[model samples]
Target: MKMKTRGNFQLQRVIGYFHGTIILFSIIIGAGIFLAPKGVLKYSSLNVGVSLSIWAACAVVSMVAALSHAELGTTFPRSGAQYYFLKRSLGPLISFSYIWVNLFASPAGTAARSLLLAGYIIHPFYPGCSVPEMPKKCLALAIVWCLGILNARGVKEVTWFQTLSTVVKMAVLCFISLTGIVLLVRGRKENLARFEKAFDAEVPDASQIAEAFLQGLYAYSGWGVLVRIAGELKNPGENIPKCVITALTLVALIYLLVNISYLAVLTPKEIMSSDAVAVTWMDKVIPSMQWAISIGVSSSIFSSLNCTVFSSSRVLYVASQEGQLPLILSTLNVHSCPVVAVLQMTILASFIIIPSDLILLVNYVGFIDWLQLGLMMTGLLKLRFQEPDLPRPYKNLWQLILVLLAGRLLRDTFLHYATVSLYVDPLKKILSNICIRNACVSRQFI
Candidate 1:
């Protein structure tokens, strides 16, 4: 029923365009959408219009990035999509650095989402009871291992689960969207009228706007998952572009609708204060329908966790194929799955869950991911000029615009962080030195 390999194992080429699309959709439509709206509104100078505008704009930018990636997928038709692109266009150093960060960021980010999933699952049961840190960490680790085992079983199994999970999440979102629309149709004037004063507050400057963009973009982070599994896709050159466009367009429309649904039911202030925005809105809509929020959130998180682990393991497996990682990581078990790579991913994610909380991982992984993404877009541009004769089934002039915009935004982000760190670094160092001095003084007294 299965074949195992010790070295240079070949990945099974069983994933078709539809399954490929499902995998990509699973990665992109995870729990982040459920959580990102609040962050967008909170960081976006409290303007409903500006916040929604940023969401829609990020979706457009994501589509551009997707098209560029689709071209790469068609041309290269390999796994480790970003790493391979970087290696070929930029060189080994850049490629290695991207994976190096991926080693930490991917798993840690998954762990953060896993933790959130556990929190949502447990929240209803223990409304007043506080969840201990160790239990949460253990639950997160369990979830990671379970998904890892499922992935190791077979690609078909994973894709089946992924497809089902994605459908459930989509249904939940559609329900919310439809319910909100019905409320507005039934003369819910106050809720629908909230958009009238979308720009009533002070405007956020460019830096703040960039930060808000990053926040919304983080929710849309999984667009690259398909590229990681390109080798498995049947007729990748034609199929990848088709899947990219279809999945991204649908996801963007769904995200826009979900946000409108939230805004239609909740005030801006209420949205900002909400830790669980979906749950908060559901409680207001129909107190009895409140449990749907928890179920929906848990389902979303589970699907996100599955896709993250699946995609991240593929990256490590591909890295091993290129000799950027140990040969052991490239080994596959009886099911044609890279079991070792999955184990490594699980271990790293497990470690991340123990000490750090959710927000730290979110911010840390989101930064590294965006940084690598900007670099990947840059590599796409380099490939266009340097290898003009390469056969790309699809190419677009808009890809160039994406590169230019990404470069400018990255430059601005770097400068903003560097400027802030300059003042903060000294304070951090002083505090560190003072704590060390106190420890040494206590030792001397003893």
Candidate 2:
């Protein structure tokens, strides 16, 4: 067994703080904002206050997990985050298995969301637009293929596009937020009263509230994409934590404010029942701006798809480089991107889109992600004890606090799994299939 070493393929460090922040933000903000409001309202009775609170709470929990990962990313500063941490802190088999699961689950989830976005984009023009009956899978496959080609060509080639798309999406969101405030101040008394009533509604059953909270949590997922690119970011130690925490904070604020905008324009019941809440709210408030919101959603989803494909390929490529996967996957093109790994991920993601199960995929990937995060947080604690002298750029004194939070998140994840198993058995079956398929694919590659 020849020992593997970092050879001629020096990892690219082209991404700066702005690119890093937007990349992380875009990955977290995709599709969820559109899908989550309805679920939040459904379970929470359109109680805007409770819904916003849930988003905040989820963001806090996710941020702690992000900070924990920041310490680990800085300590390792390697390509494969969880893979590297698990290998160094635990062992190779565990690390490889986690990467295997991620390759199948995470990219698939991202692609599934992209396809769902595509469905929404085409719906206005097509009228009969639906996920299952439409050519959404083909459209999603085309997106994956295009992004894979761009990634294969080079990261530099795609970075500008990522930056542009992110800017456009943010601009749209800002416009919406500002416009909402303006409309509210213009004395839309009836709308304001409706929103207030919605916010102050009686709490629903405990189970319903819990379910809504979980949905909100899912919307706030994907903060870990920051750690996924630790190897590629400039000044991983200082920038990793800063970028993750800042992005989460901004995301939390945007979610709260935007949901407030939705409440201001539409009643809780309307927000809950609508398929496209953002577009619907825009239609009501400023009907002519429907195209703007649609374009924004499309751009945001596209950027997210690009970033996720880029990050996930790196994860698999690193695993391959470490001998946890087939060496073919580690091969880099002239652009220094992992062509084989990108292709493999795109193929798996295409399958996810074909099935038209975005919600199922999100929950399924989220379940495993929460588990991985708990393990990552535990890894942080272990590193502090075992390698006390390691040069850590950022250290958190709240280790015990983070550990307790991780424990609670772990329990929450397990309970979530149990609840889904008991009530939504079909969802449980889909998740099982995802796990089994991932295992089989990774074994084949190895």
Candidate 3:
């Protein structure tokens, strides 16, 4: 028999294919597209060929993993993706660990990204806004709190907001893409680079290539959030797979084109040096359009923040229900939203914004997120074997290969974590290093 909660929280089946698609896109279109190109250009020049190839590589890997996830989501259309998959496949302990990591990582990462967007918005307005201060932190926290309140209102309301924001974001992106192409066509020599020079500029070695790929992958994370809401999907059997695959393809194409546009005007050195490469590109191509892109990027980040708060809080709510967290967090209001969970997540996210180096925060969040994603892939593969008889609406033939790729993704994530750990303050590093080392030792002892 199925279980029920005190709030009579029935599974939400209101979202349809379009909603699923937009939600998936919103999840993917965060601060990544704005910042990742600059990072990629730093390592591998603004060579359109090289940049597009890198994005293509990421798309292929992500698509393979998405295929496997589509099958798993179809098989078990539940709210807690890793939690449910791990419990059913491996055991309770593994699932619990996944949930624990998720509880700490998702909200913190989302909050960090939200603050990044807030920082970008404030940058144009504030003179030389480099340092983090109370005012900026407060503003970022206010964004988180406002989103939390909006989410608490209801999922339907939140979804509507997501849909509207997503539409506006897409429209602005399409305009930028179109205008950039036009500017390229009109002999905008200032933007175009000699193909030979662009390509011949310092070829990255294997390690550099690997680093670039990892950065690209981080930008491409979060397409899987759509899977997190599989249970609420109107038709999990068909929509889950379609939405994941379609949304990822669209995002990859947009990212590639946008980068091409940015490079059309800005040199690799120029892009790497500037924080707001998108704005720089816009200022060069269409100065009037700079504010539009800025607002669009800001809205993109805000929508992502809102969606993350909505989706991740549900994970916490489920954890609370399963006794992994305090029971109070599981409680829902009249709108069937996890009020306490939202508040708690918002508060923690607020604290993360205090330090406020957007790039650093994004990198840290990406590192941890990729780790979780690798684990999720492992859980998916395990579940496929253990629950062979479980009905899967969509099945991919290359499941094992995709699973291996997903496992291999850990290499980049680990490298990023190691790099960051090496650079962090020694005292803080000692404390975290102790915990990490002790955990490693304990595992070995066990």
TM-score of 3: 0.89
lDDT value, candidate 2, whole model:
0.74
lDDT by residue (tens digit), candidate 1, 1-446: 34466554688779998888888888888867876787778778788899999999999988887887677777778777777888899997677767766877888788888887777666555554555666677777888889888888878888889888887888888998898888778766797677777788777888778777777888888887877888788998888888888999999998998898898999889887665678778878887776777887777778878878877888888878888777778878888888889889988888777754453345546667767766777787888889899888777766667657766666656665555643555753564466456544533432
In model 2, the runs with Cα more than 4 Å from the true position are 1-7, 127-132, 204-210, 398-403, 406-446
Q: Locate the minimum summed-lDDT window of 10 residues in model 3.
A: 437-446
On residues 6-108, what C-alpha lDDT tens digit does candidate 2 reach at each position?
4766678878788788888887787788788787777776666777777778778767767766777787787767688888877776687788678667776
Q: List the residue pairs that clash in candidate 2.
A: none
Q: Give me the runs in candidate 3 sitting further than 4 Å from their true place.
A: 1-7, 45-48, 127-134, 194-196, 412-416, 427-446
TM-score, one value per model: 0.89, 0.89, 0.89
Global fold similarity of model 2 (TM-score): 0.89
Q: Count of backbone clashes for each model?
A: 0, 0, 2
Best candidate (score: lDDT): 1
**lDDT score of model 3?**
0.71
